[model samples]
Target: MKRIPKSLLKKLENRKEIGTFRTLKTKTALVDFSSNDYLGLARLDAISVRAKQILTDLGHSANGSTGSRLLTGHHPLFKKVEQQIATYHEAETALVFNSGYDANIGLFSALPQRNDLVFYDAFVHASIRDGLRLSRAKSYSFRHNDFEDLARKIEKLTSASSVWVVTEAVFSMDGDSPDWKSLAAICNRFEVHLIIDEAHATGVLTQLTEIYKQTTIENHLTARVVTFGKALGCHGAAVLGNASLRDYLINFAGSFIYTTALPPAALATIAAAYEKLQDKIGLESLHQNIDIFNRSVVNLDLKQHFILSQSAVHCCIAPGNEHVKMLSMQFEKSGFDVRPILSPTVAARKERLRFCLHAFNTENEIESALKLLATLL
Candidate 1:
């Protein structure tokens, strides 16, 4: 009964005043345009059925992972799935974590010891930043996707005992990518290790995000983090690297060491998703939708308002939080499911409507949404 803490109340008041207060809501019947299910696998009943089949065939019927992997939860399926992940992604070994957040937190917190220097992109995912915050290493942020800025920072401290470079393959909010080859070359020149989160580019398992599409970036880079929540339409994330790195995480990464392991269904779902990735059924349809959406944006003359991106995420700057939320309401009324990314999630002026493209989205749907958006603008 202590008046609910004045400081906490003040922060809540400030959020409401700025239109940044958040609330949970149930799913809607509006057209799909805001989910991370880029490949539409989440809607495929076959995947769910297959997941169950994989689990049963493996002779496991447990609903929970019993305990932490290092203790009692390290199931036999973990080894099998990890091997498949390594072969599919061409990594020497792979370590699966409960989620992307856990993977990054464990990797960053454990790998970079005290006195090491860490440089991350300005727009890198929050998970990586949080991990660095929990580490003892000295860290700096370079300009977003700017190799020159990163180079300057590296030059200032090239003599550090160890240096790590962190970035994302496809930025979650902006939907743009950095030049991996360029970043790799710079890291190599400065004797630094490179880490990339491929959360937004999962599913297809292509080299599309890399400048050299024909070859794998695993050897040119140090580590890669891939997740299933986005394009793969599943759960769980894995850090792909060499065998020694996996050993290191198993031995030292606290997040990996002290956490309860993912259940068998999650691992089975992961295996099923990768199988679908290999068959390439959903990839083509998803890529087609992305192409259609990209073309429709240009054709509708909404290019000026949109962020330049080749990924499934498209952002249209709407300036004010109030204005953006109003625009989102308009979109919902028009049968589109676009959502407003208000301040504090992104910077204040960067508030905008985010449209998430999916393979299930039709060309007409894409064009119609853009046409309506054009008229509103």
Candidate 2:
């Protein structure tokens, strides 16, 4: 390796001073609460088997994609999977990308033109922010989940250029969601294009059973991004939109154009995962766990410590980096896999312990975990 750079050393020193230094650790075999395998599909051998079987049935056994999809890697399976995803999400078309990061980078960096305006939530994923940083458009952040703030920002822009807006269906860190219907209505009234990253909602919110239980926001979006890595427990993501938008991405998105395509196994696994999403066992059990978790938090009087959310992700605010890390260590020592969300990743005062509920987690596990939390408080 080359000689260490002093500037890089100083940056690491600063991170340590602020208690924001990050390091990798291997996975541990504890009662789960940290991993994003919300439906526990990552542990399912059948899904892998099904993926292989599908590849065999489709006459594909390539261990690697030979090149970028635009070159030699545009397998026939891509068309089928994209169409299947489009229909499932009720979108007119869908285009697959290597990952959620790639999809977001491709969309934001390529879609927003020089004269256009791009507005995003302050707490949107880092990938989106990085994409916006690369964009030529004028961009601004609205207060998190505050539609009024978004409205005020939109009203201040006095340009004739097109406006593009983006937010997450289920925010990754906070586990809270924007009022999709209201946001969509606002975008529709303003005639601005809207995009949603459904990374955390792909399997969990499939049918949209809530106040408007029978309706989904599928038609409300100009484009939607879905990743199979979270609840779906696979790898890869897709951009959902009209055929023209798909064509535009294919043409201009350098991230999509230059990168080698996802191999047949990954594509097959995503397809199998989507098929598994339709099954009642994993997804239904996951929801039931969420419900059980909600009741447990209330019964244990730990609700106030937690951010109100109905999603698989629930956050309990810990206020300081040291304190939250200590708490997370306690949970790990007690056989729970809960992890701390440190500052710099979140607001400094809003560091939290993120509990990810899953289908494989027993009701007893949920009850015990919250009970342990109550005692700590």
- lDDT of every model, 2 decimals: 0.86, 0.87
Candidate 1 per-residue lDDT, tens place, 1-377, comes to 55888899999999888778888979999999999998888888888999899988988658899999999899889999999998888678999999999999999989888989999998888899999998999999999999999998889886678888898888888888887667766765786787888899876437643443333344456778999888878898999988889999999998999999999999999888888887875777778888888888888888899888878888999988999999999999999899998877788899989998888888889899999999988
* Clashing residue pairs, backbone N/CA/C < 3 A, model 1: none
Clashing residue pairs in all predictions, respectively, total 0, 0
Q: Give the worst 10-residue stretch by lDDT in candidate 1.
A: 209-218
Q: What would the per-residue lDDT of candidate 2 be over residues 262-373, giving only the tens digit for each residue?
A: 9989999988988888774488898899999999988888888998888999999999999999999999999999999998899999999999999999999999999889
Q: Pick the candidate with the highest TM-score.
A: 2
TM-score of each predicted structure versus truth: 0.95, 0.96
Error of 1 at 140 (Å): 0.6
lDDT of 2: 0.87
Candidate 1's C-alpha runs over 4 A off are 1-4, 208-217
Worst 10 residues of 2 by lDDT: 209-218
